[model samples]
Target chain A: MGKALAAAIGLASIAAAVTAPTAFGQPPPGAAACSGCHPASARVTSPVVRLAGLERDAIVRAMQGFRSGQRAGTVMDRIAKGFTDDEIQALAAWFAAQPKGGEEGNPARVPLPKGGEEGNPARVPLPKK
Target chain B: MTFTRRRFLGLAGCTALFPAPARGQGAGPRVVVVGGGFGGASCARALRQLDPRVSVTLVEASATFTACPFSNAVIGGLRELSAQQFTYARVAADGITLVPAMATAVDPAAKSVTLADGTRLPYDRLVLAPGIDIRWGALPGYDEAAAALMPHAWKAGEQTLLLRRQLEAMNDGGLVVIAAPANPFRCPPGPYERASLIAHYLKTKKPKSKLIVLDAKDAFSKQRLFQAAWAELYPGLLEWVPLSKGGAVTSVDAATRTLVTDFGKHQANVASVIPPQKAGRIAEAAGVTDRTGWCPIDPVTFESTLQRGIHVVGDAAIAGAMPKSAFAANSQAKSCAAAVVTLLAGGTPAAPKLINTCYSLVAPDYGISVAGVYAPSGGQLADVPGAGGVSPANAPRATRAAEAVLAEAWFHTITGEVFG
Candidate 1:
């Protein structure tokens, strides 16, 4: 029984890692930073330029331009000063991988406990608007 | 007690029906957030989004939230007060329990908050985002009574309306004085933006009227961009007096509509003396704030270093490099919510990355901004080495015009995200 429990724990750990690649099962690193201003996809209310679904290289180029002062931006140049080439690349890749409409808000931080998923009668559902 | 297949199956069914708690972890962790501003509201929503099992209750004193991000535009008459207002219908629909009551006290040991009516709401984790409260007497003779006469207009809502009315009622050539506070205030660039917007209003409506900024600090956020815009647009109409130039206002006589600075007493048709500020009273009551009058927290989790299981975000926390801006608060709230969810599941929190973009509208057609990306390192949030900056100095009209549109869009989208 003890050995079986250990094996289940090991598999669950791997599953969690596979399901949640980012730290803390939250949005990809740097996603929240863009959320408030750019969001994902495009909206009439969105002010900043959208980056989701953009080619990785294009995003990298814009970030590099801002970093090097070649790009004229409201606050991008200053903001770009905070990232390295590698971090910028990572951010670019993450955003590019996202769906056009953005991730469904943010994912659950931890996997649902056994028997507590959507269909579970015990689960407290969101209120209807 | 003997282990048998039939007995084991029966016990397993019982365990499945009533699951054991995760070691020492509590069952269905409840998170309570106080104050529904950018930080608290975002945290509450993110908490629900991050873990449906983790119950979230949001305690807000006001029925409707008034966003400070664009309240300056409202004060400048660029936008209406209604535009800055928002309801919590969406946030509630997202599964967070909305408690429309003021949190009067926090008991850390019990993990509960006593509301104004003395209802105790318990929680496994508490996020306090009670934003800045003005140090009313910090500016001499500037108390609640004086604020009624000379509106600070800092908190938005009624104060914003008061200032707007004062601006409209003033005569064409009357002088308007705006007394700006020192560093580490909410929206570091706000006073200057207000000045720019007020100047825009004056230029179009009352060109002869002049506005002066009596600043406590010698420097300001986005100084060069604002100065450049002021020079090109309303050159002589707007003037800024730095602290070294005797611009520091020491006191005000609201009855006489006069401000006393190091230089001398200056009278104006209207005055706005933005007072110095500190973390909201609830933070101190919760024992999260320290000698600096701001809460200190773990940079990654935003958990108050002073109190375990309690997190602080937004203007109240001494966020190392991040300014107390709405975007910063929203970003921190997301990260903090993640941390709370992780801890509730008996897991360690990972490092967090945050971003802040603050845009200031100098005119209806012009906007400028400062932005930065931050990460928790060396126990503090430090800006990424090469990631953020301000809008170019003396940029072309098109760029500023585009930024203006972006600023509006940002305001709309962020408010929607926070409230919708």
Candidate 2:
């Protein structure tokens, strides 16, 4: 094998070594509460739109859009589609209680609108394409 | 230029805030990092990036990292494996002594980690970011040999290739069965993406072929987005059997290449089973893992609560409120690296912030994702509420494809953070 290939293989074994037998930590207390409604942790924070200040009404609409093919992540969208209006609010309430994304957001850096502030209740009004 | 008294005072104030490792502590101390995937690589790279004086040794079992992040795209035919693969070339250039060895034993009390070849390396601190391993027998007849017959392809390398080959060679009307494992595995959206990609290929090449998903759970990550796209794009070509409908495969007889599920026995032209997983072996060997088969750590510093002088990240450590995704591993790894460096430097580690964004493609141009902000709290890191949520539903194809593009960029950004 070439030196590079040999080096690569060597690294793979070490990776295999570290991951010898573990998968992940146990789900937290509320994880089951969330999983019953959604499979994975649906609310993940990134440098994009903030999950804080999310309105239940808006969340429900978005979930409906996703479920109906007006949204994306077909899997998640469909799951959202199945939610009753009440469940959407529960999801919104659950995620809204979490903290804002740790990363700074520059919506203009890519696509979407400027994010909302902590108490400002910045609703991401559907983009006015 | 020589530092003036006034300038010296300004720099000194800053140093006091984030005190550098007391230099001439004789090349500081050595930090041995295991695993070259996102978590390990990020920790190793970050250690060197932040501290110029620390002597860092990174021992990895593989030379090339086939990232699970982009490997999904490769299976979708959007990219090749080479596009997702990386070498330690850049990390090695960063003044880190990259070792090609597997850590077989970790003597935390002695602060030394032993490799498979019996090479004992000592460290002031040891960082273990080992990923995961399949419970080979969790599903009956799913031993190492039998796995070859029905590839799990969970690791994102050869199995990915093998799974791809079988899919490519399958006939138009052939049946492709994807048996998804239970919760808490590597990459929540992974299995869904695999189904979507396979469907993409079938829709184009063999429109009549079937892509069937047998899921242990009724719901999966990004379910809405996946289903929406499937109905709109690959309708009648994809069928999902939930656990209630005998989706869970209890066992498989590789000799006959048949899968026996809770419902009944089924034969398919191709079968892929994602087995249940657990923390890597070394964590168990080091006594860091608990009875649950994963290492329990103080979520703040990601230090093993069960063992001193040892930190576990990635799929090995039980990190609450975070999906076992690549981004979470990288974030947790970076924070762990920071904390280890701080403690070794004789300073209190600062609060760490963990961030993650896991994107999944439902079809060739359709993608969705979930993002979150997390921080160590009390004794664990919990997800920030309303900070992030899954992708909106029924988005335009442009937006869906935009997610796919963004996922690739995020993959590049993270891998660069770890090993680039």
Candidate 3:
């Protein structure tokens, strides 16, 4: 179910990327509050997932689940219940507005040099052992 | 800088009396932050993230930030001290000026901070996140010299290493005692978690060993859940003595590893003496701390209620009901950053919703947690009704295991948010 939703969001994001150069308006001021847990848009290794470039509607729906206690969360349920509907909407729009892969304003998606010859010489893999 | 009386009139109540930067004379709002722990680092980064126009200078005494949240894991040998360590590289990379100096004094009226090296940093606003400093001499015989022998391990880094070393050196079937402090300490669940983790180490490594927790408080956060877990997972290995039962460690003789209480004295192969703490000395030096040894701040803006132009966050600030945890510090920092931005822009600060989630590992793969969402109510941060709770006591093992994963995840994510 999670994969299916991700695939659907992927398709929608591609379409939105092509049609609308921007996702929404300026990032919400309170959006930084979420940064304390979800650092940036980039995929983080921690269990607490990132929220940089998810679909606005999906983000809103997820927050609504947390708010209503329909979603099982370690901490988000309590945190979401504190926000008003409007604040959640603003948060969703702000996160969604960030460009996914690499964009000027998005701090999360700084591209890493692919490994092998393209990466730093110190980290370059040696010949096959 | 020019003393423009009229310009200061509009921001009378909020802004302190300082030479207002002449129009376009200076670049932007200059915010100077002290202490580079969760609170200071998060506030510095959030200020720049929220508003690029603001210039942030973070004054941290240490080069690397050692997180207290996961220090217990380090003590238990589950995690390395390196894992709990963080650098200011990310904050500096994010455009905040990282000042490696100890802040000695904060002059609110002049809006300047004096560092140890005699560097006076001027600021439009100052944010103080000086984490707790142990109130030496409060607990008789528990001083710096004693801490060297009976490590507190509360501040992380060297003390944590000292505790770990002591545990590793101790023999099997030995008695490990932890003297926990009274209420309003840095982390409410920390001492228990340390006891649990230490018990796990002793059980796995030294099966015959025993653990004792001598707590000053009668009860603790998540008492039922912790007690239940101990009975189930580490039965006969752990014991807890509350204050009513003569638990408080009134004094410590580090030379002999003996803790003296009103009832009697208890000796141990190894001991952890967590002394009472207060707001960092800088807060007191600045005259922000009151009789309670904590700085009072406006819940809405985190501006010092005792003095203007200075805001305190993290363990030092009296944040109403918020526990002094890394999560609370980071949350308060974000809100404080926003308030600084809004107030500097000549706008009224909006009410903020603060959140905190403190997770403790009872044993490896056994976790318990308490979460809360707070809002400004009657000039203090109050827990929103029906928005906070502790993990269920009788929950399934799977639930506890999942929470353990979340607990690990929370440590990494929060450290990244604050320092990364």
Query: Candidate 2: where is the Cα deviation over 4 Å?
Result: A1-129, B1-26
DockQ for each of the predicted structures, in order? 0.19, 0.02, 0.14
**Residue range with the least summed lDDT across 10 consecutive positions in model 2 chain B:** B8-17
lDDT of each: 0.80, 0.68, 0.79
Query: What are the per-residue Cα lDDT tens digits for candidate 3 across B221-282?
Result: 98999999999989999999999999999998978789998889998888998889999999
TM-score result, candidate 1: 0.84
Better of 2 and 3 by DockQ: 3
Better of 2 and 3 by TM-score: 3
Tell me what TM-score chain B of candidate 3 gets against the true chain B: 0.95
lDDT of 2 by residue, B1-420 (tens): 244434533543343344345643345567888888878887786787656656789989887777787676666566666656777877887788899988899887677889898989887677888799888898999988877768888888867766666676667788888889888888888888888888888888888889788888989887887888889988999898899999998988876668888789877777788889988887888889888888888865677888766789888888887788887887777678766666665554544545666888777567788876555554566554335577777567888888876665565455544544
Docking class of 3: incorrect
Candidate achieving the largest DockQ = 1
Q: Write one digit per residue (lDDT tens) for candidate 3, span A3-121.
A: 55445433432332332222222234346567666756243445565787899999999989988989977677767775656667767876887866321222222233344222322
Q: Is the docking of candidate 1 incorrect, acceptable, medium or high quality?
A: incorrect
Give the worst 10-residue stretch by lDDT in candidate 2 chain A: A120-129
